[model samples]
Target: MGSPICPDCYDYLGHVVWQYHAPELWRRAIQDVSRQLAARLGVPVSKVSKVVSRQYGRTAEMQARGAVHFHALFRLDGPLDEGIGAACGVGVDVMVEAIEAAFSRAQVQAPPTFECDQSRVLRWGEQIDIRIVREGSRTDDPDAPITGEQVAAYLAKYSTKDTSLAVPDGAHVHRIKQTCAEVHEAAILRAESRRAGEEVPVPVDSEGRDHYVLIGKWAKELGYRGHYSSKSRCYSVTYRTLRRRRARFQQVTKSRCYSVTYRTLRRRRARFQQVMQEETERAQRAGKPVDLAAVEEALLSQEDESETSVVIGVWEFVGVGWTNQGEVEIATAAAARAREYAQLRAGKQ
Candidate 1:
């Protein structure tokens, strides 16, 4: 269930454009909130902790209109002395009011360099919603209201998906192009009637591909390719920092790294133990029982008493192929399948 819409008036292109700018608009709205809070607290704007944000949206097909609405999760922070966590948790109402104030004054400007007819400048849609997230809760039931973790997860989920509004290969483009061409043909027919002084209704190309003054300028957005990830000053960690940490981890765990070399040697030791186990199992199956339990116990005791050694700067593959642990697992599974197939064939014989 979502908002009401009329297809003729609910421009799909406009919805797409909004998606593209949604990220920027959200950031502005959140910043506006922080600013208001700082002003009320008599603290410098810089001292106001930043809020983190996550992206979320809804796509609904309605009565001839497609509505795309977005929601954002915002987290607030504070200075250490004031106990930031407690402040943000308890002052949600204050934050909400501040955010509402900011939204009232928030205006998103399109890129200045683009040439648009001032007559049809775009802006945010009519409806806006802001809800405060509560602790340890997933949702505020519409009848009972409980929004929190549910809100955060929701926003974070959409942080990476762009709507299929203008998919280069999507159905919408074919429809739009066909519609435009039909409108163009109709206009030409009406022009002929007009020359004869007939009051024929003329169809105007309100949304033509050549009309950069309108939706054409935003075509690349299909029309929504906005900021998918954002947060207020005090929300959570930055995307940049997360990316840096991942890069660092990758560097340390690089295939040629010393840790990988050590892991390789460990695998080799495991393989040797596995071979010994297999030989023991075969000996038992042959009915020439040679204290199999005692042999297993001895092997375990030896393993416990012996320390496996590994080189710090070299990586090795103990198995037939030079692959790491993960790859080895995959290879081992394939080998098992092959053995099963061979056994099945032998059974058929």
Candidate 2:
């Protein structure tokens, strides 16, 4: 986990200070950590096959203590074995130490501006929690086993939340409002300077370049900027691939159903027409009335020979319905109507 320090610098810079660039800062931080871990493990950067990372954010109190914090997950290739290491041949314990070192070394330099006095150093919080994931093994903590499914669900749930929905009672909210006002004033000044053909001074960092902080653009987010979730190229299968697979499945199913139904219907129709033609020719040759019952029986016998027998059943009437009162009433009415129709068909109505 990484968090920003709420320094006194914010009094001058407002919420658009170095901390506002949490997204970029942590991106660099994670990269640094990965590089350091790879070097320690003796793995060449080109040979590294998999490195997955994701980021999640939470709003801090609006007071001076308020700033966005990040939750991150990292996965490396292979098991926790020395053989998997590249150069130094270290294991998981050593990798964890390398991460700690990287966090300490990772820092974000501020673009020299009136709002900031100096570049800010970034690091993880003191409460660093690291755990080893193993299959079918529970942890000592009350949270118990840390399965991949649980972790994914946890990250996904928070990633979709609205950051702007945080309560508006904190000091951070006040600073954000103040920053909005300042940004508005700056825009007006820039406009006037441009109309007067005057060169408006812009703040630059130590690199001697103009800092790009479009304060108005991020005012609604309280100047905090970063993606809720991100992943490396080789992390997992992409959304595009899943969608394509689903589309193909649906297409195949539809084609199969249509082809089967058309083939069956065509075969039955051809057989029926052939049988009728044969019966007509026999009647004409005999010069007598057609034996309709025998012809029908012959066709049915041919069908039985060609395919499986069609099962038919006649059951005695039993009590209607199962449990529901409404269903019982409907079933009783249906049974009475069925008996009346049967009697009429038998000429006994």
Top-lDDT candidate index: 2
TM-score (all chains, Cα) for each model: 0.45, 0.53
Off by over 4 Å in 1: 1-24, 44-68, 80-90, 108-126, 137-147, 160-162, 165-220, 232-234, 251-349
What global local distance difference test value does model 1 have? 0.49
Writing each residue's lDDT as its tens digit, candidate 2 over 155-213 gives 76667655545434455566655765575466555555656777756544455323543
The best candidate in terms of TM-score: 2
Candidate lDDT (C-alpha), each: 0.49, 0.54
Tens digits of per-residue lDDT for model 1, 1-349:
1222454564543444454455556657656776887776667787664432222233221112233345555555444333224234336666677767777787665432112212223444567677665566554467545466676566555654444431334344544433434433444555556567776332234352222223333344333334334344334445665685586455445553335576545764685577578766875686433333344345434432223335598889666774578988988899999999999999999
Q: Candidate 2 regions off by >4 Å?
A: 1-15, 43-66, 78-90, 112-119, 137-145, 169-174, 180-209, 249-349
As for candidate 2, its clashing pairs are 41-86, 42-86, 42-87, 43-86, 62-170, 62-171, 62-172, 63-171, 112-205
